[model samples]
Target chain A: MESLLSPVILFFALGALAAFARSDLAVPEPLSKALSLYLMCAIGLKGGVLVADNGFTTELFLAAAGGLALSCLIPFGAFVALRRIGKLDATNAAAVAAHYGSVSVVTFIAGNQILSDAGMAPAGYMIAVLALMETPAIIVGLFLARRNAALTFQPRQDLLRETLLNGSVVLLTGSFAIGLVVGKAGFVPIAPVFETGFTGLLCLFMLDMGLLAARRLLHARRLTLHLVLLAIVFPVINGTIGCALGAVLRLDTGTTTALGILAASASYIAVPAAMRLALPKADAGLYLAMSLAITFPFNITLGIPLYSMLAKLMV
Target chain B: MVISVPHRKIEILVDAPLLRRLRQLASEAGVSGYTLQPTLGGDGDQGRWLDDQVTGGAGSKVVFTTIIDAAGAADLLSVLEPLLDEYGLMVTSSAVEVISARS
Candidate 1:
């Protein structure tokens, strides 16, 4: 309940309310983009600072490997569910599967924020995990789509560029690297912007995200009831699996919860562009409706706390 | 008096991610130049989408405009036809008078 009532979450609710009420509230596109960049940078730097303090640990490698494996493998399960249960055709199913397999940056940020407030702040290496988990599912999804006889596969340089070097991946990884190089002492000057102002900026960003999600949901014609249910269900199942994986690996509770959050979250930004380029025949509306509208709202509002509770149970 | 030359103005409303492909097709069709403009939001066969979407390139679209000779327009349309159905691209070409020097 406390998690649900947090200012960031409340602002998100407010944005959704405004959208549902047909209010004209909007975030400027450039400002929204800027906010996203700021958040990524802040996350990366903080993660780097923590790593600087902790040095190299075996846990980081274990988490990274687990995250990579989950990313590579989860799409297969999602592909099947989307195909058999949701009755999505091959291309759309594959596209949607890729989104499920990838991580949502904002969701991870929100989950991290909630956990930190609860005094379970996850390890910094989870940021690295977040960056690593962005692209592999896209590859799996393309493979799944290609297996269908009707879909034609073409190798394009731009698709490769978009998938691997998308803006979020680049900024997140680059900032992480910058933080590593700078370390804690070097981070002092910029701490005010990235640390002190993070939650407030996140609140503003959440407002925009709420508006985007609800507005997209309102306009979703391709989304079916089955698809919506799957959107919610995917996170719970995958997140639980993630929590189990973390516990089996004997990670701390916060890191375990963070892993669960990553597994459960769906990509809205990076994978969508890749899908547009690679799976052009796929229904963007359907996939976006599922990921941005359904899964995202579910995670921020309810899924985050649920995963945290599940993490406690496992770890 | 300035003389206006007849040309076909090709305008394509396409998803932002497809802008690169559109530009490549335009170049392939021998168009010398084109302009891209962002759209606010609109409802169409696929439903409504807003430009400010945080999902980045998926829901956002751009208007790609180019003025070219009739043959060039025909070539562009021919190249784009294959992708039109798959991408749901909205393409239109109209006869227009352009100031020859500016064009």
Candidate 2:
């Protein structure tokens, strides 16, 4: 309840409301992109400092492996559901599946804040897992879609290269590694910039996101009744799997919750870019509407809280 | 140096995903060369998009423009019509008389 009411979320709500009312309020494109960079750097740095203090542990290795497994496997399940229940064809099914498999960075950030405020912070090394989870699902998705097609899937190399050196991945891992190397001593001087200002920056980013998301929902196209239901249902199922794994791995409740939120969260950013490369024939309106319009808001508003509750149950 | 030649100015504002194919298609269609520019913002039937907005996919926009002889334009346009039809790209080609190749 508190997480839902936090200024961060409320501001997001306000943005969505403004958009719903068709107000002219909007975040300029360049500023929004810069906000994204700001959030990633701050989160990565904080995670790095924590890792520096705690040092590497075996648990981090298991979590990374667990996240990778989820990223790669969830798509297969999503693809099946989209095909059977949603009645989507090969290209659209795989495109939407790829999104369900990949994690959302902002949703994870929101989850991290929710957990930290609740006093059981997740481990720092989870930052690395977040970056690791970005790519494999895309590769899996492309392979699944092209498996029986007459087309050769000639753009795999381009997709692979784009995914590998994607701007988000590069910035995220680079900042994480830098934080790891610099440790606390380096972060201390920069704390005022990255740490103190974090929430304000996040609120603004979420505001922009809310405006975009609600507008996308208003313009939602090509989504059917079954597809909408599948979008909601898939996250709950996938999040549960992740929550169970996190608990079995002996992660604390907060970390488990964070993991669950991640598992449930679908990519709106990275996956869309990758899909555009890998599946040109796929309809952007369908996949983007499903992921951004339906799944993203669901996760931010209800999914995080639900995943947290599930994590608590597991613990 | 200057020369007058009849040509087709091909302009393609396509999703980033199609960039590689666009280039390849242009080459196969025998264009002299093309200038590819990364687009930061655009609007279309799908919706408004910006490079900075983190919708995160290969959905970033790109603009590819090339000038080719009138002879090759027909073949390129033939291929592009179906390609654009399928991919939902915004494309246009217009006949132009080249003022100068080099100056």
Candidate 3:
């Protein structure tokens, strides 16, 4: 119960209410982008710092590898389920599948925040896990789309360029590399800008996210009940599986919970843009609404705690 | 001053892939190039904006083409019309003056 009233949840709830009330409140784009970078760097540097403290082990490597493999595998499974259960066509299924397969950076950030607030610490290498999970789903989604018998349109080179080098992936991985090179020494200079300001900026970003969600919900009538149900159901199921994976891999409680969060969160930004390019025929409203509207809020408000509790039991 | 001809400018809101296809068709229609700008926000039949909060959904796009001659415009329109019919696209064309023509 206390978990529900945590400062993180309160921020999300406040943002949601403000948005629902139709306030013109907003977070500027560049600032939001900068906040995103800060979170990535903060998380990455923290991970490196942890590694510096704990030292390397094979278990860390195994966990990171597991994250990559699951990311690659989930999209195939998601594609099949989306096709069979949701009755989505090939392109739409692939587009939706891409989302499930990719990790959400914001969700990961929130998960870390929640864990930190709870005074729990996860493995540092999990930052690498978050970065690793970004690309494989994209490959799987593209593969599924290209297999259509009537597929007439091919994505342009520029679209392909954008997908692989999208801002989130670039910043996350780039920051991770920077963290490794500089380690504790480099973290100091940027600490005030990236680390100290992270929470306030996150609150601002969540505000924008909340407003966007409310706007999307206004157009929610366009999506069918099946998509809605899938959005709610799949994340829980995926998170459970990820928890079990964390257990088998013997990850710590915090790391396990973080893994569960990673598995549960869906991509709203990078995946959606790629889908718009690779599967233009798929309705953006449907996919975007499902990911942003249903899944994002669920993870932020309730999913994190639920996953954390489950991780405690497993770990 | 260069005399501008009576021509239709077709603006279509399309995803990146279709935008690429349109540019290819424009080149085939003898248009040397067209301007493609990233869109900030708009609404349509599928719905208005996105659900991540209106802001995350802010960057949906539209492509603009300036076709001076009728044949070139027709060729581009012919290829684009059928695609738009099946997909989430807004197509509207208006007659406008070029005012200045470099070509």
Candidate 4:
């Protein structure tokens, strides 16, 4: 409940309210893009700095291994549910599954904020886990889409390039590397912008996200009740698995909650672009509606707090 | 008086991720040059999308325009036909008069 009333979350709610009211409230596109980039860089740098302070530990490796396995395996379960319960075709199901398998950078950032406020900052190396979790689901998704098809499916080299060199992945990992190189001494000079300004920028970005998510929900025509239910359900199930893995691995409370948040979140950025290129026949409307409109809102509003509570119990 | 030459104006509105493929098709079809423009928002069969909302350029749309000879336009259309339905690309070509030097 305290998390719900934070200024950042409240700004998000305000954005959604304005959108629902059909007000002319809007963020400039270029500014929104800049905010997105800034948030990634800030989080990446902070994560790196924290890692520099803590140094690499066994727990980091364990968490990374768990995150990678989760990323690679979650799609299979989601694909099955999407196909059987949602009644989607193979291609569409695969596309949607890929989204659920991946992580949302924003959700992780929000979760990290809430957990930290509650006095459980996640491990710095979790940022590396976040970057690692972005792409494997795309490979799995493509495999599932082509496994039963009659058409000769030749994997394109360009798709591989795009997936690896996605802008978000590059910026995030690159910033992390920079932070690793600069270390804590080098970070102090620029701490004001990346650290001090972090929450304000995140608030602005979340405002845009709230507007986007709400508007997408309003405009969604292809999202059925089954799909919506699955969108919400995927987070709870996947998040529980993540929390369990973290607890089993004996990670601290904060890092465990961060893992749960990552598992629960869906990719609206990286995977969507890759899916568009690789699975063009899949319905973009349906997949985006499920991930961005349904899952994103649910996570920020209720899912994050739920995962945090679960992490406390399990960890 | 300025003299004009007959040409076909080809405009394609497509998701940003597929713009590269569209450009490749246009180049293979022997198009000389083209311009790309960002769209703010629009509604179609896929529902509505706003440029500000899309972070990865996936749901965002772009407008690609080129003026080419009729033969080139036909060639471009043929090359794009296979993907038009698959990618939900909106393509239109119309006869237009351009300055001879520009053509």
Order the candidates by TM-score, highest first.
1, 4, 2, 3
Output the worst ten-in-a-row residue range by lDDT, candidate 4 chain A.
A148-157
Residue A141's lDDT in candidate 2: 89
lDDT of 3 by residue, A1-315 (tens): 666676666777776777778777776666766666677767777777667656678878888888887788888888888888889899888888889988888888888887887887677888888888887888888888888525555545746765777777787777776777777877788788777877877777676667666667666656778788888887898888788899899988898888888888888777877776666677788787788788888888888888999999988
For candidate 1, what is the TM-score?
0.97
- Every candidate's DockQ is 0.61, 0.47, 0.31, 0.54
lDDT by candidate, in order shown:
0.91, 0.83, 0.75, 0.88
* Alpha carbon deviation, residue B25, candidate 1 (Å): 2.6
**Model 4, span B1-103: residue lDDT tens:** 5679899999999878777777787889998799999788888777777665455556778999999888888899998888776776898889999975532
TM-score of each: 0.97, 0.90, 0.87, 0.96
For candidate 3, the TM-score of chain A alone versus the native chain A is 0.93
Cα error of candidate 3 at position A74, Å: 2.2
Clash pairs for candidate 2: A269-B55, A269-B56, A270-B56, A272-B57, A273-B56, A273-B57, A273-B58
Which stretches in model 2 have alpha-carbon errors above 4 Å?
B1-5, B20-52, B56-58, B71-88, B99-103
Model 3 ranges off by over 4 Å: A48-56, A146-149, B1-4, B16-40, B50-59, B65-67, B71-89, B100-103
First chain TM-score, candidate 2: 0.97
lDDT of 4: 0.88
For candidate 3, give the docking quality class from DockQ: acceptable
True contacts kept of each: 0.57, 0.57, 0.25, 0.51
